[model samples]
Each structure stands twice: as structure tokens, then as C-alpha cells.
Target: MPNFPNIILFAIPFFILAMLVELFVTAKQHIKSYEMKDSFSSLTMGLGNVLLGFVSKALVLWAFLYVYDHFRLATIPIIWWSFVLIFFADDISYYWFHRVSHTCRLFWASHVVHHSSKHYNLSTALRQTWSGSFYSFIFWIWMPLLGFHPAMIMLQMSISLLYQFWIHTETIDKMPKWFEAIMNTPSHHRVHHGSNPLYLDRNHAGILIIWDKIFGTFQLELKDEKVVYGLVKNINTFNPIKIAFIEWIYLFKDVLTGKKSIKNRILYLIKPPGWSHDGTGKISNDLRNEWLIKKKTYDTK
Candidate 1:
């Protein structure tokens, strides 16, 4: 199989063209979800990701190949059924990687870059993480060991990512219920980007929605509640470097000087973002639980 870079190079032009079309449509339709500085920052982030990937992917590929050559259970051939099998396997891998990224402060430090932008548009999809490629691929290391070829896994992973590109938008609202039920549509993805308490850390599926449904991370978009894109506390800056590493900086700062014990400092890295030893931070579930209590009180009243 061809390398992931070679396979994904074919999609870069299409990604650019699609962004242009989204920009055109936004202008024509009076959509105000996009901003110039934000879009440029996103593009730069994407370019940085690709440039960094050219080097980092080599290390990741070496690790995958080493496992594939030595410990693979069986030789998985490049057959049609193999693609089908990999689709589910890779999607599940992505679901867990995404979930873990949101939960662990260490991983969230990298993933927070993608969510740094407040805009919900095609360009937001281009807001890839510079540091995510370092640890995110750990989620799929088992695939090569389970007999899937490294190239095959890389190819399917790229396809999954390409499929996700278009869903990061405000143009298409809702799809057919059946389609939305089965696939990750714009509506589903919008919920994922939402900073709303109810939507935080929900809808973490890739390519297919079944994993989210089965795993209880799925949340439907409510007709009465609008989705607020970006983090609960917005970063409020356009610097790509800051956007990429601000979370890491904050994590280290908390661990070093947040008045926490050494054990708690370590736990802060493993615990969800927004966790604090002094009872100040709020994790996603904490936020969701607060929302539920408020909602229940409002309903009762």
C-alpha cells in the first residue's frame, strides 16, 4: 500500500477548493460564522501539521512496521473485506483517541488546538493539531499487531479524516434522520464542536455513529438549544503557536504551582481537563452534571 502522505496528497487540493467554495457560499448566503484571521490561522495550522507530519509520520510508520513484522497475529491481505474490517477497527480507534484526548489533560493539550477557533466552518476542519500526531497514533498501534498492514491502517485513517472535513460547517444543518442516525453528519459534528455544557465531550465518533450510540457518548442536537462552538472559556487569540501549546502550558503551570500535592499534580495530567485539586476546575462530566441539575430545577419550577 502507498504511504499515507502519498494517499492524502491527492486530497489537499480538494480540501482547499472545498474551503474556497464554503467561503463563497458563506459570503453569498450571509453566514457570519467565519472570520478572516481565524481562517488564516486555521490554514497555517493545517500547513504546519502537514509539514510536521512529513517528519513525524516516518517515526510512527517505523513503530507500526516493527510491530507488524514481528508480532502480527496473521497476515491481513488487501482484500475488499479487509477494508470493511479496517473501517470499523479504525473508527473505533478514532473514537477512543478522541474521547481520551478530551478526557486526559496530557492529550487534550494537543487536541485543544483544533478546538481553539470559535468559528464553525469548513476551515475549522483545517485546524489540525501540531502535537496530536505525536501521541494520537498510539490509539491505533494495536491494529498493526492485530494483523492489519500499517499502510492499510494509514490509508483508512486518512479516508476517515477526509470524511470528517466537510462535517465541520454550519452550511448544512440536519440530514435525514436515518442518515444522521447511521453516520456522523454536520449536525452530529456540530454537537461535537459545541461548548455548551450539555454537548461537552459528546458525539466522539468517526466515519460511523454506531460507536457513539453504543458507547453512550452520542447526543442529539436540541431544537431549543443552539450550539456554541469552541471551548467553554475561549482562547481569544489567533496565534497558531499559542493555540497549539496553551493547554500544555496551563497543564504544566497547574502541576508546578497550582498549590497541589505531587500526587495530585500527576493525577491532573491523567484526569480530565478542568480537573483541579482545589475544587476550582470543572471537567466535562462535572459541567454536564451541573447542567442537568439546573435543567431539572428549571423543569420542576
Candidate 2:
């Protein structure tokens, strides 16, 4: 079983190369985007993630090892087949992790960094969360406890994450029907990143599309409607600190200001990102209206 560091070392180069290819393609298509604004923030957040992975993943692996040692579960030899199973299992775990990350205030604080970019490109893929490893790892710990080795779990997670990187692009409009139906493709991911009403919280598949379909969170991209990327109330600031913690701060502020009961306060945190106390301004609806009006004008053109 390869260590997490080794897996990262092998994957980072591939990721970089793939991102470069995506950038070249995006440039050729004349897409307007930003890859380097607040780069230091991305670097710092990435460094923080490395540290968190070391501490949290180590502890989780230790706990899993303890359980495995105590139960004396038959140690399966690492093989190609095990890798395939681990890949699928890791993806399944990620689907839940991502869904919860959006739904939970504590997790959303970390997850919001990735969505801060209004432009969806390969660079957006590198705009990762600094604090996501904390809550996100819980979803995958079950894999190791269920008898898969910690190293195998980590490898599968790495591969699954690597596979998702390509799906962050707008360059590839869609894939073959069967591939798009089974796997998370660029079209599916674009919807996930879109702020459009129909796209909100949709297509949360990690590797397989089945989870989103089964859970009824799946949404197809409408050709007539263009995607407006980023959050409802866009975080205009470039500060990574604000980008990461803004929602958490806002959630706390909402709880403090509102006369709502504890249940409602809790709901504010767990509800979709733009759900307001008075229901005055819904980002999803505003975006939907904006999209509809734009579509109307384009049709006239």
C-alpha cells in the first residue's frame, strides 16, 4: 500500500499537466477567467490542507488500524481488483462528504473557498478548501473500518479526486450519453458549480452519477440556459480568510440577529447557502430570473 504522500507526489504532476492542457484549451476558446488572483491565498490554504491531512488522516488511520488489529479481520492482499473496489467506495464516500459539506455550516465554511471563483475552469479545480479535511474525512473513515486498509483508502480517494479534476471544465460541453449517464462529466460538474436555480445543490456525484440519480439530486443542463457560476451573493473580496469564513460569520450573525427559535436558527445553517431569515432575497431565484431574461434577449438576437 502506497503512503498518502507518495500518492500525492504521483498525482500532483498529472494534475498540473492536465490543468495546463485545460488552460490551453480554454484560452483557445476565448473564455474569460482568472487563475492567479489571490494565488498566495490558494497556496496558504493548500498548505493548511496538507497539515490537516497529516493530523486528521493519521488519527483516523490509527483508529482503523486498532479496530482491524483487535478483530483480526483477514488482511486482503493489495491487488488491481482491490484498487477498483477502493476507487468506487472512495467515490461513494466523497458523494456524501460533498453533500454534507454543503449542508453543514461548519463544513461549508471550508468548502466555500472552492466555489469563490465566478469562472469555472481547470484553475478552479485547484481552488481547494483549507479546512475541508477536518469534516470531509469522516465520510471516508468508514472505508477503513469496514476492513479496507488505510493506505488503500487513501489511494482510492486520491484517484477519485484526480478523476474529478477534469470535470471542472466548460471546454468539453458534454460526453457520450452512456459515459455522461454513468460518470461525473464536465456537464454534470458545471451544473454543480452553477448558481442557477435549477442547478443549485444538484449533481453531487463524486465519481459515479448513480448516487445523484438515486438520491434525486440530479439535474440535467438545459442547452437553452447558460450557467452563471459562483455563489448567489458573490464574495467579491479577494481575501482568502473572508472567502473561507464569510459564510460561517454570516451564519453566526444571522443566528444572533434573528428572533427565530433554535430550530429555525439551525435551519439557517443547514439550509441552502442563500436561504435568508425573512425570505426576502433568494439568490437562486434572482439568478433564475436573470438567466431567463438573458435567454429571452438571445432568442430575439
How do the residues 99-198 of candidate 2 rate in per-residue lDDT, one tens digit apiece?
Answer: 8776666677778888777888765776777566655777875666567887777667767777777888888988999999899999999999987777
RMSD of 2: 3.9
Compute the lDDT for candidate 2. Answer: 0.75
Location of the lowest summed lDDT over 10 successive residues in candidate 2:
38-47
In terms of TM-score, which candidate is strongest? 1
The segments of candidate 1 whose C-alpha lies over 4 angstroms from its true place after superposition are 1-5
Tens-digit lDDT string for candidate 1 (1-301):
5534565678889988988888889888898988999999999999999899987887888889999999999898988999999999999999999999999989998998988888999889989999889778899999999999999888888899889999998889888988998999999999999999999999998889888899899999998889998899999999988988888899888888846678998998899988988888888898899999999999999
CA deviation > 4 Å runs, candidate 2? 1-5, 38-44, 70-77, 256-269, 276-301
Error of 1 at 190 (Å): 0.2
TM-score of each: 0.96, 0.82
